[model samples]
Target: MTFHYTRLANGLEILGESMPQSRSVAVGFFVQTGARNERPEEAGVSHFLEHMVFKGSERRTAWDVNRDFDAIGAHYNACTGEETTLYYAAVLPEYLFAALDILTDILRPSLRPEDFDTEKQVILEEIRMYEDQPAWSAYDEAVALFFGDHPLGHRILGTVESITALTRQQMLDYYRRRYLAGNIVVAVAGRLDWEATAAWLAEHCQHWPAGATPRRVTPVVSRPARKSVHRPQVNQEHMFLLTPAPPVESELRYAAEVLATILGDDTGSRLYWALIDTGRADSADMSYHEYQGAGAFFTYLCCEPADAAANLEITLETFRTAVRQGITEEEIRQAQSKLASRLVRGNERPQGRMRSLGYTWIYQHEYRSVDEELGRLRAVKREHLSQLLEQYNLLEPTIVALGPLAELAGTVFPAS
Candidate 1:
């Protein structure tokens, strides 16, 4: 199976992967606008808009939308993020056209006053719900500290107060600006004819409005100033260390990914053997997050309150050791192989391939074949990983910890 691409008369991108061997079609609509696009006063508008699109639309009630998809045995859902809002589904190829129609209708939603009022309450409740969870709340605080004044720091779910005060007019106004043909990419995968899909889009979307894909203002991420979050109520400690890194497009990102795996993977990872295998921590791992022109490497460690201080020191030493001694050639080869295996296994299903294509296009604005991706991962060198660890100030990290402060009191919590 391979990817096919084109554009509609109205500028909606039509992306697809021809998979004649598969029985289902995995399709998605990628919108370039998200939380970062919102102003301070309208913090949760993008997420709110995601919910409103499902509440009701011009042609179908939310129930009808669900029933129709269920009738087709469709797997459909939508999610909002800091940089993108995606609506996707997998269904029998026969139902592909209908699925696309349902999606397109929902995309251009009818923001009814009554529905907006109800959804606002629901959104506020969601905010309250997340606040109750220590991990979610802690991460939000970390982001606030990490990103500071940058729009990237804004939470996708926004705040309870912000959602509560948000008006239907404000949401409608934002929808008018951000949600349009130009900002969307329609991607589909699996046993489908690209010609038919293209014609289907031409009929449905050619009349829709047009605009260019929205671009995010890349943030200048600095080292964390005050990194600890002391939530005294929780039983255990959740600690995360952050260091700035490269974006999705940068060649160095592949190296960052390899470095992260070697440092934090479940097994054979430096942090895993040092922290998790030792039973000093409940879970510990490293992950790399990449956006348009900004990215960060995160090392997350969770452990019993009693081990907080020891675990914190161990985690720091783990990175410091990597910087000084560096990873071995054997370790780099193993990490690369592991990553390549994961990528191949993950894309075995058309749904996974569907998502990969959408994100690659949305973020990189280019298509990278599976072979190309594997080649890049394979190309990573021991020096690339070691250089990044030393070049980036991975040793002096901005730290954020949540949970009981008693056991971790003086040692883990950096003075804010």
Candidate 2:
């Protein structure tokens, strides 16, 4: 598959990946603004806006929006993450242009007050749902601990308080400010006519106002770690050990992936083989996340409250050993092969292709063909991994623990 990219004078990015012989096509619109783009008071606006768009658009009523896609058996959805919001649709190749048209309408929704009144309850329910999930709750707490008062620390599903205070005008204003062409990208894949699609997009999108460069914001710096938080109502402990790393564009980013893979990639991974297999913890894994301009790597673990300290020490020791001993050639080979294979399989679906194209377009501003990325992964050597760890030693991790356990009382001493 080859990915084609072009930028219009208005700065809207048009991206496509050709997947010959595929039965369906997927198209997506990605905006760089997400929870990280919000203030504390506007915490859930990004997600709320995502929902509102689907409720009604200029040309399509909410019922029509549902009927059109449902009639075609197409799949359409949107999601808001830390730094990006993606709207996508997957339908048979024949419906490609129609899907694109419908998506565009949704993006520039009518924002009716009736729709807002209806969707507010939905968004509030979403917040409550996340509140009840322990894994979700702990992960959010860890992010707050890692970024402190920074925008990155803001919860994606803002509190019910914040969501209640948002007015229709406020949301419309936000839409006006950030929905410009310069900050947007359109990614499409599978069977399609690039020339035709591009022409259609250019025409429909011209109504979108041109360049207004988004104001630059400073990067997040790790504050003192929040060691441990306890809610006695919980049955088990959830903990995170995080440390700073480089941005998505950095070479060290790949190394962090390799390190995370070795620690908790799968059943054979260090944490899985050590903690879970040995019954020392219920679940354990490491996650490496790279933000648009910065990165953080962490290990998240869950265990019985009594085993928290021993499990924490074990995870740290495993990581330290990997850094000092370096991964074996076989382990590197296995991890690389596993990652490559998964990448290939994941893109087989139209939805997956839409997501991959959207992600690359937003993060790199240039679409990286899947083949190119695979080659890079294949070329990664153990020496590269070792050099990365040596240069980017993240020994002083930010720790956040929650349970009835007292081990994580104050800040992890020597905040490092």
Candidate 3:
């Protein structure tokens, strides 16, 4: 295996990880703009634009775009998140250039008024669809509650009101501002020729303008609060406890991930034993989410309305115990092994390796092999977890709940 990196004169970065044994190649265009980059009035434009990118382009109709990928038997998709948007495809090594051409063409979308108007309804429908899910709706609200006025808390799928009023001009303006050459990374992995790939990108992307979009990186300050929404139509309760954690660039990120797995992995975890296996909750887990300059740790549970209070207490107790006593060496060892195994297995595939390569460069501007990542995971210790628990003030979290029972919001748990 070999890694390659190149930068065009216009500042576009092209990266490739060549795996001799792999039969498929994964290509991705990662844009450094998402929900957080939008102004208040342009809330969902990033995601809405993702949909429009597929609607049509100057050289290809929407049908042509879809049919062409199908012609090559490629698996392709795109998604938008809080901090980034990705367009990607996986194809046999022979179809690498075809896939790359199609992806690059769509990046310079026509953004036709007709296409924009048609996709507006689709985006609105998507927002309504997610609102119908109790867990999804609760988690979205929890992020807003936790982040307060921070732009990082903005919804990836804008609210119905924002989508309804957003205009095509606003989206076009945003595109021109954020979609500069320097703000994007083209990443590919698997069996490929790096020199040929780099030359292709350099020629095709020469016309793209060069400039980096600046991002606001205000430090997040979280406060303890509790809120609940009554969704009488839902049969189960969804709850989330959110607190700060190590950001993407932090050295403590490895320890934070291990701690989350030890406390809340789906099976053979502290949360599973106290909640799921005990039948106190239908689902329970703790996860760490990292963004460019900020991060969050989430503890989530779903249960019958009647068990909401009891389960909430149990979850709090689990966190308090870990904070007070720290975790056992055996638990740390198991978490390291579980995480290392996942890393190795995920990298075995070209698509997973492509994603890792893109995101690592986007966030850290460096590369780490599978061995280096496993080493980081294995380095986590009890003292590392202890430091994270104290440094992040993980014991105090903003709580959000959604269900048939409004009373659950008022239930209180003791602090660490």
Candidate 1 structure quality by residue, lDDT tens digits, 350-414 = 78888889999987888877899999999988778867876677766667778877334444423
Measured by TM-score, how close is model 1 to the native structure?
Answer: 0.95
Estimated TM-score for each candidate: 0.95, 0.94, 0.98
Cα lDDT tens digits for candidate 3, 201-256: 99999888899886879989889888888999999999999989999999899998
- Residue pairs in candidate 1 whose N, alpha carbon or C atoms collide under 3 angstroms: 182-211, 227-399
Best by TM-score: 3
Task: Return the lDDT, model 3, position 164.
Answer: 98
Looking at candidate 1, the ten consecutive residues that score lowest on lDDT are 407-416
Clashes of 3: 0
lDDT of 3: 0.91
Runs in model 1 lying further than 4 Å from the true structure: 406-416
lDDT of 2 by residue, 200-315 (tens): 89888977878754635668778546666767888899988777777887767766777778778756898999999999888898878888777887788999887887787777
- Residue 66 of model 3: what lDDT? 98
Q: 393, model 2: CA deviation in Å?
A: 3.7
Error of 3 at 247 (Å): 0.7
